[model samples]
Target: MIHITRTLSIPDSEIQEQFIRASGPGGQNVNKVSSAVQLRFDVARSPSLPEAVRARLTVLAGRRINQEGILTIEAQRFRTQGRNRDDARVRLVELIRRATEVPELRRATKPTRASQRRRLESKQKHGDTKKQRRSVGPSDG
Candidate 1:
């Protein structure tokens, strides 16, 4: 079981991993060994996540989540399979932790009197500058 937090733990069965050939930093081992870890988590159908968490996870995942609702993460930074696998799990935990957080609601506020005055002052200043730049009339003293 992977513990995302004190309240949330995801079972190993929820995560599916595949080993594929990787193309970075392994020299000749890159050609011979399938060290890349392709981690798939079905956000839409996971029993571990609550409905709200699943929804947020899907949105957070963006392009990583496919049309079929599978979130795929490829970890191949390390040349060894064990490191790659651990990297993927860590990433998964981080993503889940992010999704678990509820964003603070925006408190609507009216413009302060001072702020409104400053804004109007700046606008008037800009208008005055533009007015001065315009060609003066011949009739003007």
Candidate 2:
């Protein structure tokens, strides 16, 4: 089981992993060994997540989640399959933990009187500067 938070724990059976050859760091060994780990988790069908968390997770997953609602994470930073696998799991847990937090609601706020005055003053100052740069006309004499 992978524990995301105090309340959220995902069973190990829910995760699927596939191994593929990684392109970097291993040199000759890279061509022979499968070091990259592809981890897939069904976010839509999972019974472990709450509805709100599931929705947020889908949004957070972005391009990682396909039409079937499976979140795919590829870990290839490490040369060893074990390290890559662990990295994938840790990333999944971190993503889920982020989704579990409730976002703070934003309250509507008006500009302060001082701020509004300052904005108007800046605009007027800008306009005055532009006006002074205009070519003088004979009628002004």
Candidate 3:
């Protein structure tokens, strides 16, 4: 079981891993061996995740999560398949851990009276400065 938090844990059955060839430069070894790991987790169908966490996970995953609601994480930073697999799992855990955190609610606040007065005063002062810069016209008697 993979433990995300004290209250949340997901069994191995929920995760699926596929190994594919690692792209980019590495000579013959990279061409021959499949070192990259693609980790997939079903966010919509998972029983382990709570409804709120699932919603958050979907949003957080963004492009990573497909229409099927499968979150895919590709790990190819490491040359070895084992390291890549571990990296994929670590990333998945981190993502889920982030999804578990509830964002604090932001309370709507109005500007303080003093601040509002200062802002109006500042605007008036700026307008007066602009007004003083205007050239006196002959039509102004």
Cα lDDT tens digits, model 2, 1-141, are: 999998789999999999999976878989999999999999999999999999999999999999999999999999899999999999999999999989999999999999999999999999999999999999997
Which window of ten consecutive residues has the lowest lDDT sum in model 1? Answer: 23-32
Q: Largest TM-score belongs to which candidate? A: 2
Regions of candidate 3 where Cα sits further than 4 Å from its true position: 128-141
Task: Supply candidate 1's per-residue lDDT for 30.
Answer: 93
lDDT of 3 by residue, 37-97 (tens): 9999999999999999999999999999999999999999998999999999999999999
Model 2: per-residue Cα lDDT at residue 115: 100
Candidate 2 has what TM-score?
A: 0.89
**Per-prediction TM-score, please?**
0.87, 0.89, 0.87
Please give the distance, in angstroms, between residue 112's alpha carbon in candidate 1 and its true position after superposition.
Answer: 2.2
How many Å off is the CA of 141 in candidate 1? Answer: 7.4
